[model samples]
Structure formats: structure tokens, C-alpha cells
Target: MPEMLMEVEEEDDVVPNGRVLITGATGLLGRAVYKEFKDNNWHVLGTSYSRLRPRLEILNLLDSSAVNGLVQDFKPHVIVHCAAERRPDIVENQPDSAAMLNVGASENLAKVAAAVGAFLIYISSDYVFDGTNPPYKTDSVPNPLNLYGKTKLEGERVVLQNNDGAAVLRVPVLYGDVEKIEESAVTIMFDKVQHSNKSANMDHWQQRFPTYVKDVASVCLQMAEKKLQDPSLKGIFHWSGNEQMTKYEIACAMADAFNLPCSHLRPITDEPVGATPRPWNPQLDCSRLEALGIGQRTPFRAGIRESLWPFLVEKKWQQTIFH
Candidate 1:
């Protein structure tokens, strides 16, 4: 808790007047956004559908009427849309439901924002790419490979179509702690180490640009403030950490950060082995965001250290400790 407080203080120094409305506030990124805003004295209002309790308001984004009602009632100056069907396998299994939530709900929010003249900051993904390119720029055409990516892409388009003054931020793989890291790419590898006492056959070939969850939240708030100040800064932008590395490299970094045995991690080639297709390359070029003076603050090792500390403290391999 003390460490979390210190981190909050550091974030507060960057942004003042943090009043915000965050969707998916129960998730890792959402929680981080909430804290970032709250620490900065921003009157934050959050929404959540799952049983997971949020610090502020909780509403189901899938419910259209509910979303509309909340937006109208809250009259938030900024809306950070973080809620979505993020799982690739589940999204593939139920594309329609994913569309309903990811696309439909987002459009509803956009409409509400327009009615109230609120600034919108929609969180997007790097999965929108097909993985053929090493590092995708903001101008690159999106070629999604899966239902999740397609749905998120549609959501982005919906927001843009609905609002002329909206900011859609495409971020890469985001990692942080609020609950256990059961499904995250980084946590899955940690699970392998915990049970097998050996690293899973590492797919060293697959490259991904991982963004720290807190940094992502910080950028979101900063972008929201920028949009509020200058309405013309409207369009799609790429936001990610400074460095890019393969899954094996990330695993090694996490292991080294936590003082764990890295020998257990073994390198493997890029080969598909499951029903879901993974992009071999999904690194994003964040120069667009950097030009806006919103660069990643935490280095890979430090971010890994911050994320791994809770698991080490709990003596349990959990992805998040707060939620």
C-alpha cells in the first residue's frame, strides 16, 4: 500500500484536475486509471459489470439504456472507454456478443458524449495489426487477424463515425496487477514456472511491445486533458512503451526483476499450436504520442519489477493484488 501511494504521488505531479469517468474500472488498466485520476484530485466515476467492486460508480456497459442514463446523469467532462471484450479466444467463440459490447456499446457511449459535448478517449489495441510488420505506425492500415481485433477495430471506427472530435488511442500489450495474472501473456509464463518449476517452452520468436498499465493510464489522462484544451487534436494515435522485445525476452526480464531462475525459460520458434492465431509481430511505433510529449516513463525492468513485487510478497503467483 505504501508503494502504491508513492506511485500515485508520482503520477499526480504530472496531471492536475483529474476528474474523470472510466469504463471497465475493475480491470487492471481501469483500476490504474482510477488511481491516477483520484491521486491527482480528479473526481473519478467508474463503471463495472462483473461482481468486481469499483471505487466509484458501477454500471454494465453492455446495457445501452444504463449507459445512456449514466452519461447523462454524470455529465462527465471526459469519458475514458476502457471496457471491452478483450479475450481473443472468447471473442472468437462469440463474435456477435463481442460486437454488441465492443462496437454497439462504444457507439452508444460516443453518442452520449456528443449529446453532452464531452471529450472521449477510447482505449484500443495493437492486435488490430496482422503481425506481419515489425513495428506498426499510426498511419498503417489495420488488418486484424481475429474476432477480438476486428471487434475492437469496429469499436474504434464506431467512435470516430459517431464523434468528429474523438481521440482513439491504439495501445500495445498492457500488463499490471489488480488480480492474479492467470490469462495475461506475462502471468501465463509465471504460472508455468510456479507449477512445473521450469519455464514453459518459450516462444522466443514472437515479438510484442508491452506497455505498463500505469503508463497507459497516465497517457490516457494526459491525452484527455490535451483534447479538452485543444479540440483539434482529434484522430487516431499510437501509444506504447519505448522498447520492443520477444516473449522470451519479456520472460527473462520478469525473471531477472524478481530474482527468479531464468534458466527454466527455453526459446522456441514461431509456430502456431492452437485454435487462436497470434501475430508474430505487434510492436507499435509511438512517435505520434511521443511527439505529443507523452512517452513511457517506466523502463521494462522497472515495470517488470513493480508488477512482480506483489506475487513475490504474496508467495503466490497472482497477476494482480489490488482487485
Candidate 2:
């Protein structure tokens, strides 16, 4: 299968330009993307349905009229769609709510984005592929195992169908400067282990690429800048870290990072607790992303060092800058 990537001209950091509207501002990736664009000199407007913060507007995505109205008011040159019903359990139990928010909302946003003639960037997932695939490429056929993946795939279709110029970015498990521990998956284990001090079991068989949200944001800004200049750069693009490790390995790394009890960390090889059938290996081939001039990937250890929550507990923010 042929991979799809739109390599646009690179820009200088001393100057950042354009206007970006980010949905789901309260979410991990959304928060990072908002900061990324801002740091790059783009005027960014972020939205959250529940939480209201400085520079963040409240907009109900389920309400098309409200979304469209906001789009008209803001008139952003780029619309980054990060809002979605992401939890697998939630999507499984509440299919209608999932479809309405994940699928329907994206459809509406695509229409509004097109109306404003803005470049639409939809954040997708690696869940679209089954566990059988080790290294999923942009051209890989989607074989979603869960409702969340199905809904996201549907959202991607709606986005691309509505606006051909829209860019679909598929990422893996993410970690960021989290307001809450739940914001980052790896941190979830860290939280559990730190508090428990007893033991933690992680899936050793299942492999994942825990991409850094800041890195995701950085590459996204690059895509947005290129999209703003080149309209032809439209299609499904895969972006993730080169680092590949299982959940067990991730937990161990976090344990060391937080100075938690590493000995308590155990691998679940026989049966993953409450484990749902998922793509065991969804390692993304980022050569396409690299060809676009984005080559360096944040190492797992280094990414954890730059992320937020850990710093609050230990003040390690001075360790590094955004990659």
C-alpha cells in the first residue's frame, strides 16, 4: 500500500504566523497543540465544552449551529479537531453518544471548516488497525477492533469526504503536561503504583508507541503551516515516536522516572486484566513524517522529563524544551 504524506516547506522559529482554532482544549493533545501553535507565533483560539480557561472558549460540539457560529466568529485559518469520545469503554457502552460526539461532531466541524475555507486537521488513532500489524503505515487498511476506533475511523472518513484538503493524523498512546494524572496513560500506572506501593501489573505482550503530545503538537504545527501554503497536501498521515515498547516497559520507565517501587512492577503475560482485544503492535512507520523534514523523535525518558505533572512533584521542567 502506498503511504500518503504532504511535505510542506519548513518555517523559521523566530517568526510564527497564521490563526489556529483547536477543539477540546482541555484534553491532553489539544492543550499541547494550542501551546505549540502559540509558541510558533500563530494566533490560537481553543475551545472546551465544560472547562473555561483564559483564551479558551466554551463551545458545544454536539450543537452544529453553535460550532458553526463559533467558526464564523473566530474565522480561523486552520481548524484542528481533537475533540472525541476517546475512552474505549465509554464508546462501547454509549455508542449513540459516541457516534453523536465523535462522528456527527466531526462532520459538522468539517462543514464549518469548509465554509470558512480553513484547513481541517483531524486527530485520529492507531486503533484503526488490528493488533496483527506490527508497523502500521498510512495506507494500511483500517480493521478497528473496538467501538472507539470504529468511531474515529468514521470521523476521519467524514472529515476527508467533506473536505478533501483535510489532514488526518493518527497517533498512539500519549503523555503530556497533564493537569491530571489521567491525562497521560503511562502516568496512570505511575499514579497507581505510587499510591499503592504494593504492586502493578502491565501488559507485556501488547506493544505500543507512547508518543509525546508536545512532539505531536510540533509536527502538527509543521503540517498546518505547510497546509496553509500548499492546499494539495491532503490525506491520511501517520505520526508517532520511533520508540516502541510494551505497556510493561512503559510502566517500568515511569516507575524509575518517579522513583517509585520498580520491584513492584510485574508483567502480565498470561492474561491482561480486563483486557479488550486490541492491536497488539501498532508501531507507526514515520518515514513519511521524516520525509517531510520531521525526523527527530522524543526519547521516552526525555519526553517524560519534559512533561508537566512529574515536574510539579519534582520540578524537572528545567530539564528540557519542546522537541
Q: Among these predicted structures, which one has the highest lDDT? A: 2
* Model 1 lDDT tens row, 245-321: 77778887777777667787788875757758877787788888888887556898888777767666435434465
Per-prediction TM-score = 0.88, 0.88
Residue lDDT tens for model 2, 74-185: 8999999998888888788899999999899999999889888999989999999886856878988889988889999999999989987788998888887877777666
Q: List candidate 2 stretches off by more than 4 Å.
A: 1-16, 195-197, 258-261, 271-274, 308-323
Candidate 1 Cα outliers beyond 4 Å, as residue runs: 1-18, 194-196, 313-323
Residue pairs with backbone overlap in model 1:
18-42, 19-42, 19-43, 178-320, 179-320, 180-319, 180-320, 181-319
Clashes of each: 8, 2
Worst 10 residues of 1 by lDDT: 313-322
